[model samples]
Target: MNNTTHLPVNPYLPAPLALPLSLVPGKTYSQVMARLLNKLFGPELADGELDFLEGKIMRVDVVDAKLHFSITLSQGVLAAADTKCPHDLSIEGSIYDFLLLATRREDADTLFFNRRLRLGGDTELGLYVKNFLDALELDDRIGPFLQMMNGATTLIGRIPRLAIPKLPFPKLGRRS
Candidate 1:
């Protein structure tokens, strides 16, 4: 028999956002994710925290979105592939789970233990990548952007389901 303690379901937890997979072109998704990753890792590389990733490729697979991309640190620059590429390690998880990790709503150990996230490929490289992310201080690196993203996520979670449109639409209001 399994002896693992299952986490209790929380009533207050927000339902996962439904992605308009059909509407978003595959190329667009890849470009957007790549840009985001580059932005995220740029400062880390500049600070030398990601020196361990030099010459190594790490792939992140968003299972639900059917999206995967690889990133490598070379010559002190972090570059993300526009499409799938050979990787030394891969991390797979749902977008929601990844977002939770990024926003600090969940820890890597808890997610990994619960099987919400999985790692594969080179074990040593994977462990190194995991440890790097675990030790990252997002606030020190991308404080304003991280804070804004977290705030947006929290605001979306608080909105009533009935108030949200079934289809997402661009707000044509004044731009901030």
Candidate 2:
């Protein structure tokens, strides 16, 4: 008799999903991060939500992407440094985990408990930053833009992995 018995797959478990390429090749992490910060922190600055970071240096490391960058608020403006600096706090996590946090798909505590996110340097400062982010309502802050980007991302990920030659114009007259 066979020793193994078939078991049903757990439907509650997350299925593996392919993520579409988003980062541009050859672009330095700082450059990409600068663009992202300009979008994410610009509003926060205007709203005075980032006042606490005015004179603090914070470093964020994207482990899987092998990217590291430092952030500072100078005169209420968010700045990004290419190299690591003497940071008051540091946050480290994989790009996927960071994205989950940004999108409110997961909480910082949950990620921390699971060991997917980490904090170092000044614990108090790190906790302050974490609390600030947790309190901030991202959905209300960048609702439409985030939704559009998320939709586009999902659509791109769902596209078939087909390698077809690029054409300048569509074949308007043909059904195929």
Candidate 3:
């Protein structure tokens, strides 16, 4: 006689991405993040989430006359430096959040206004970095990573929906 046993399902366990959830911005952000990390960090560094940043940092310190970027990684941190314009940036929110929001080209103005994102160091530097990230098309390099991610999600019987958050316009009177 043969006996077959079935495993019980747990709802708490993240549901599979099979149904292709609604068009949510968070998903788009995730994809961009994967691309940036793959391009900037490399494949070897793709161990875990925080692992990508370990011991890696390139600080813009300052860029242009109105921007400043403080790039920090698990490897190192770089602060944008500028003399003409000064910026007061605080590193409070999750770096993951900043990275995600920064990838959405042409969304910085809205991002800053809605406070969906924040910057550390010079404001101009941050803007410049945002612009740079927007122009970068990590697709060629990021495709494989994204494929792997989607494959893994699919293997578990789920569908992934690609979406990026909609940033709000910045408030007036704030330094650009």
Best by lDDT: 1
In terms of TM-score, which candidate is stronger, 2 or 3?
A: 2
RMSD of each: 11.6, 12.2, 20.6
List candidate 2 segments past 4 Å from native: 1-28, 144-176
Best by TM-score: 1
Q: Which stretches of candidate 3 lie over 4 Å from their true place?
A: 1-106, 147-176
Clashing pairs in 2: none
lDDT of 3 by residue, 20-108 (tens): 33223333433444455455645434444333334333332211112223333434322222323333333222222343333332255
What is the alpha-carbon RMSD of candidate 1 to the true structure? 11.6
Ranked by TM-score, top first = 1, 2, 3
Put down candidate 2 lDDT per residue, 15-67, tens digits, no spaces: 13312222423135555676677687676778887777877888887654555
lDDT of each: 0.69, 0.67, 0.40
